[model samples]
Target chain A: MSATNRQIRLAARPVGEVDPEDWEHCAGPVDEPGPGRFAGRTRAISLDPAMRGWLDDRPSYLPPVGIGEVMRAGSVIEVTASDHPDFQPGDHVVGTFGVQEYVVSDGRGAMKIDTSLAPPSTYLGALGMPGMTAYFGLLDVGALKDGETVVVSGAAGAVGTIAGQIAKAKGCRVVGIAGGPEKCAMLTDELGFDAAIDYRADDVRKALRRHAPDGIDVYFDNVGGDILDAALTRLAMHARVVVCGAISQYNNDTPVKGPSNYLSLLVRRARMEGFVVFDYADRYAQAARDIAAWIADGRIKVKEHIVQGSVDDFPETLQMLFRGENVGKLVLELV
Target chain B: MSATNRQIRLAARPVGEVDPEDWEHCAGPVDEPGPGRFAGRTRAISLDPAMRGWLDDRPSYLPPVGIGEVMRAGSVIEVTASDHPDFQPGDHVVGTFGVQEYVVSDGRGAMKIDTSLAPPSTYLGALGMPGMTAYFGLLDVGALKDGETVVVSGAAGAVGTIAGQIAKAKGCRVVGIAGGPEKCAMLTDELGFDAAIDYRADDVRKALRRHAPDGIDVYFDNVGGDILDAALTRLAMHARVVVCGAISQYNNDTPVKGPSNYLSLLVRRARMEGFVVFDYADRYAQAARDIAAWIADGRIKVKEHIVQGSVDDFPETLQMLFRGENVGKLVLELV
Candidate 1:
């Protein structure tokens, strides 16, 4: 075990695209587990689009990570030392463990994750918050019905990938909107998406109209702005737009574009609802059980783009999400 | 009865503010009632903010009124002749009778209104489409709850006036935002609103923060530009924004200013839902009955701005809606 813990801290709030200067890499003495406390070494870290929102100094589902603080993150940590009754050494846990080599917890928000069923990285992907976000955002907020035509933007990303697969598993026709040819191919060929539109190459509105010929009944929008506008224009009657995240507008220096075509809600008698996954904490266990079963049954496919480096690699790994370089669940595995 | 029908026809689509050239004053032979038809002389015509949306050539809840066609309107008509099974001569009815001195209808969307209960102008105002819009938009779309903080824009206008009163009737704390001091006074004093914000004088966001200190639960947005943005900023957890109309953007020569703060929906885990009253056509009867009871019980005050004029005055009367001159429901009464 390392005598010192290396941590990446927020140096400044990001403006438009996040810069390297916005983060600081520092090392501190590793804390010994005291009474009712547990210390863990981070094995895998989750890189999420929502992290960008947390960096902004504004009110959201969670308060922004203040400057000079260890950056807030969702990570799979292996308990190396423990004094807490509930958490034992050798047990793996998942929680808002900051971007650091080690984490100390009171076991408040941390949940012991079983790695025997799946790998540690899988806990950061399909069995984690992104998985739960896709689940509740689709089923609960969207009120998805069987045989409904579903469209998802940012379809190659973490939540989008799982959301599309879940829609397909539930007997819905799924059309995915992604960026490149590679990502689009991966969506259709590997992820079982019925159709995938490369948003970079095709006219999204036209492609959506062709793919979702019957009009979209459930639009799981992770990318807001123009794509959201396109989805709005093609909504079926009583469509439910699940606003999980808006990655497209997160890094914008200008104002986030509100969907001008929102009036489509009135025309189609539809609804648009935004949700936070933390709101569904009580049902996470059932959702995880269902997701695990689907994974075992081959109805869901898990994808991870793991960057191997120290905690210092986080800034670059996060940038991959905004650049649309990562294929699925982007993660940082400490080496 | 008049020998010729004096009609207002759509001459051209308005660019920004509606101009006199957008309408054509024409005279046509008054059609006699044929089989299963009724002919009626217009008693009072409804002038609505929604009329602005109908003039634009766009896909909305209803199709845009075509050039050279009689401008579509809702009016109270006194039946002069009838071969229709549902109607008889001397019966007063309400329907999409168009901007004309006389109308012949097959009773498709027409409902016979009793003037003994309320005046003809009231049917075009408080007891008509505007009334139904407030009822359903507030209760159904807004999903209003008692004790919730409700804020309404265009609070002195037709739908806004009725919506504020209905929210008050349902035991909600209501705050109204209107353009002028006179209109604002009407909202608080006559309409039973808890507070009123004169948007012209007060900084709307500051006023909203002052009035709804705890945060707003239901926001009934009628005038949708900056005021909508202000309301978005004050949304509480799980807020419901009822987008009944956007009169502020209806006449814009440029693109409509989509609320810049719409991301507030995501931050607050809220919803912004648009609704057209016509979509609730099946339930309008029940809603009307409830509204009538409220009016009879003095829980809801009816406000109407009646203009005594010919059908040709419609172009000028309609302008009153955009100018924010009328205090309540603006109607043109043919005397």
Candidate 2:
């Protein structure tokens, strides 16, 4: 076991795109697990677009990560010591364990994840919070019907990839909008998406008109901006726009562009709804079971882009999400 | 009957606030009703903020009022001649009869209204399209619950007045935001609202915090823009915002200012839904019945600002709505 813990702390609130100056590296003596607590080493840390929203000093689903504090993150940790009833040494757990080498927890929001069925990193990706977000956001918030037509933005990213695949699994026509030709090809060729539009190479509105000629019934929007406005123009009657995340706008110095064509909701009798994955805490286990079954049956493929690095690599790893550099789930695997 | 019918034709599309030149007063030969059709004399024409939206050349719930065409309007009329089975002379009816002294229709989308229950002008105000807009926009689109905190903007206008009363009747705590002290006072004292905020005099966000300290559960928005941003900031968990109209933005030559604080929707796990009243065509009868019962029981009050004038007075009468000069439902009663 390591004698010291290395951690990344928020040095300042990000103005627009996060800079290296916004983070600080720190070292501290490792503490033993106290009574009714467990100590664990982080094996993998999640790098999500949602993390950008947390860096802003504004009201959100979660409180902003305060300056000089350990940066808040979702990570898979392997228990090294335990003085709690629920946890034992060698058990793998998933929780909001900050960007650090070691963590001590009282088992408040932690759940033991089985590593035999899938690797520890899968718990931080498809089998974890992102997976739950895609499942509930599409099924409950989006109110997706079986034969509905779905269009997903940021379709090569974590939640989008899972959401599109799940829509396909439900017998819906799924169209994905990703940044590049390779990412777009991966969506149609590997992820079972019916059509994929390379947003970088084509005019998204015209491409959408070609691919979804009937109009989008369920729009799972992860990247908001002009693309959202285009999607608004092509909404079918009673369309459901699921506001998952706005990766495209999160790094903007200016205000987030509200969809100018949002009034389309009135013409189509449609609705746009926003939700947080934590709101579906009670349903996570059931969703996990279903997702696990799909993976076992080869219906839903698990996609991860794991970066082998130390805790100091988190800042650059996170920037990759905003740059549209990584595909599927992007995570940092502590070596 | 007069030798010619007096009519108002659209001379040009309004740039910002509508001008007198946008309308041209003309006299035309009154056509006789053909087989299965009816002819009627206009008694009262409804003046609405929605009319401003119809003048802009954009895709909306309804088509733009084309230049050189008879201006589209809703009016109460008395059947002067009929060959249709559903109507006869002396019957008062309500329909889209345009801005003309006389109308000929094929009995489609026209309803015979009983003046004995309410005045003929009431069919152009509280008991007509405005009433139906309030009914479904609140209960259905806003998903209003009995004990919820409801806040309404443009609280003294046609749909706003009706929507506030309906929310109050549903056992919800209602707060209204209006432009002037008189309109604000009418909301509380006459419309049975729990509180009223004078947006012209006081800061709306501060007033909303005072009135809805628990945050707004349902927001019935008519005058969108800054007020919509304020409402977004004060949303309670799982709140619903019904986007009925945006009278404030309809006259602007610049692009509409999208709400900068719309990310609040994600923070509160809330939704903002837009709806056009015409979509509930099948349920209008049921809604009208309930509204009539409420009016008879004294739970809902009828408020109308009637201008005694000829058809040529439409340009100025319509301007009254944009200037916020009219108290409740604005209508032109030809004298």
Q: Evaluate residue A318 in candidate 2 and report its C-alpha lDDT on the 0 to 100 scale.
A: 95
Q: Is the docking of candidate 1 incorrect, acceptable, medium or high quality?
A: medium
The number of the candidate with the highest DockQ is: 2
Residue-level lDDT of model 2, residues B180-235, one tens digit each, is 98998888888899999988999999999999999999999998788988999999
**What pairs collide in candidate 1?**
none
Q: What is the lDDT of residue B5 in candidate 2?
A: 91
Report the TM-score of candidate 2, chain B only.
0.98
Provide the TM-score for each candidate, comma-separated. Answer: 0.98, 0.97
Task: Name the lDDT of candidate 2.
Answer: 0.91
Among all windows of 10 consecutive residues in model 1 chain B, the one with the lowest summed lDDT is: B255-264
Off by over 4 Å in 1: none
